[model samples]
Target: MEENQELEQELAMEDVLKNYDFKKIHTGEIIKGSVLKVTNDEVIVNINYFSDGIINKDELSFESDVNPFDVVKEGDEISVKIISTDDGEGNVVLSKKQADEASIWDSVDDAKKEGKTVVVKVKSETKGGLIASYKGLRVFIPGSQAAARRIELNTLVGQELEVKLTECDKVKKNIVASRRVIEEAEIEAKKNELWSGLTVGEKREGKVTRLAKFGAFVDIGGVEGLVHVSDLSWKRVNNPEEVVSVGDTVNVFIQSVDREKNRLSLALKDVATNPWTLVESKMKTGDVVEGKVLKFTTFGAFVEVADGVEGLVHLSEISDENIAKPSEVLEIGQTVKVKVLSIDAANHKMSLSIKDAVEKSKEYLQYTDNEEESTLGDLLKDKLSGVKFE
Candidate 1:
């Protein structure tokens, strides 16, 4: 009878050992279970262990206004972090959201190290950018990292995007994603592929993708080239929009290439007839020309005599009267008549005057028909010699 009792006691001890496994709790272990009951205070989940686990309402969400029903319901399968074993109640305190966050951070770290693209779903909009979900983990995508072009975060809600993991901090539980980096990498790859056989002075068709103050960005077969405002047209341009608009198809000449910087300088005017080529033949010194006022500086006003050809009218020569500034005498886009005093083709400069030409014309009228013609310089020297100094 004593032997039989000893065998029965051994069997009972084996049953107890099977029931209480004494599982080890590590830092980042994912414990899965089913929600047995949920209430405003806490959620009870059964993990088929010795006892059910309890997750407090506050641990259910990172959001402040969290409702238990929104997160879990009865008989719903769930996962939780084994925060700690129960005291005397024989229950385990768990955190569903925390476990998910820990798992996500691990994945994010791996993605960044391997340069892998992660698929994320847009969850909500924040002031700075969008909040996204990746494998049940919340990640932040700043506004500048959202796209290669500006995009509205509101429009991206509920959309899935392939993003590269830029940063991940397990201690702070912060994860940052960047879709722009992936886009830029793709663009650079495409640019390198397209530039392999390209040569200078090559003519290509492109579409204007962006118009900035200084230049327009054109897309030529997935490669972007910059056409500076000065290269857009022979005529002076105040704004890039005056020459090209976003989405406009245009023919451009490759002016230069910097493979190191991945820069391509494009020109629209190079492909067109050069206005300066015919300027020297059509215009000469002492010629009366009509021009439009283009810009004014402190010292002078620049007049557009022809396309890409501008002559400066000094403030002192704008009128016989004294003027403080060129703007006082000339307004932008106003038409004016002036005489070209001199032209230097090599230097690309033209000196213009209105008062000097009028004086010269008056002196010619005063010369007698039978008298020998006197040069203007000779007359001025003779007149100055006769004046007595005090």
Candidate 2:
């Protein structure tokens, strides 16, 4: 009788322990867990349930290279979301990433409402734009909203960019961001700052934004200015495209600024680098050079000796004979040889003489004619005239 009572009491205590171990937990439940073991691939956590929960490396963080030990160590308490009650191995599957995503969504929503910007990492590119990850949520930045139109969208891949949330719909699980919004705001602020300190004759480094028949438009610190074709270079420019192209960086001189019309006149070539500054290195006085008649004036004819450099041929110097006007001897677009009489580089002026060049040509021909007639027999006769031969 005593042995039977001992066996019955032992069976009753076993049934009570089994009932206590049965904790009613279902899938998709938020539970508190303690890290039991951590490894490179997975982490084991005890959730005070019948089975311990398994948190894989991918579930611990959205980053691919995350270490499970770095996320959770032994004896650390963490909140996790239940993925499955049984992962076919009788162990519960939990995700720490999914649990943190809920709070990230709330933060994104608040940022949208508060008009704040968020920083996101660009994961990849899609058909129309870029795909970025804000925490674990995917945010779409359209091509038009990705960056300024001048910037290539693909260059932003794998870079962290700050963006403004244009649309945040938590119910639909859709989020749209715009880097252009942030860039445009910064541009406007820079424009205001530039205008406050803008002055005529201010030198600036600018990027060529557009080309037109008359001029090129350049962006100088958020303000645009026009560089007229004539001012593009000292050399003649038929079109602005010949001097500058779109997206070219150049230095510009602000000639004038009209606040009322919002117009700016810019010059690309300044006096410091003008062709006249180096004219003496190319030619000097008394040097004869071939030139083309560019235009005829009442005083003389403007002849081009070099590109962007013209010399004046006075009416008296146009020909050896007297002339009524420069056009009588020289026509526009005619090629003529001229001698440099004087030069004033500081004033960008040069005086040339075509008559002197013609005279010098005659003297050179006469000298060559006399030399061709001389022979070796004439040189021997001249030397023997003062000596007696033995």
- The most accurate candidate by TM-score is 2
Please give the CA lDDT of all the candidate structures.
Answer: 0.84, 0.88
Determine the backbone clash count of candidate 1. 0
Q: Write the per-residue lDDT of candidate 2 for residues 1-390, one digit (tens) a residue.
A: 999999999999887667434455777777788899999999998887777899988889977789787777899998899999899999999998887887799899999999999999998989999999999899999999988656787899999999999999988989999999899889888877887778777789999999999989999978899999988988767788878899999999989887778788899988567788788998999999999998887888989888778899998888868777888877888999999999998887999999999888888898887776676558878988879768
Q: Give the alpha carbon lDDT tens digit for every residue of 1-390 in model 1.
A: 999999999999898777555665443466788999989989999876777888999888766768999888999998798887774587888998887677667778888899999999999989899999887677899989999888887899899999998888778868899989988888878877898856789899999999999999998897789999988998888899888889999999999988888899999887547777777899988887788988888888888899788888888878898889887767899987778988886666888986676676666666653244556667778889868889
Name the runs in model 1 displaced over 4 angstroms: 15-19, 23-49, 52-79, 87-89, 197-204, 208-218, 224-247, 251-390
Model 2, residue 246: distance off in Å is: 6.0
Q: Supply the TM-score for candidate 2.
A: 0.57
For all predicted structures, in order, the TM-scores are 0.48, 0.57
**Among all windows of ten consecutive residues in candidate 1, which has the lowest summed lDDT?**
368-377
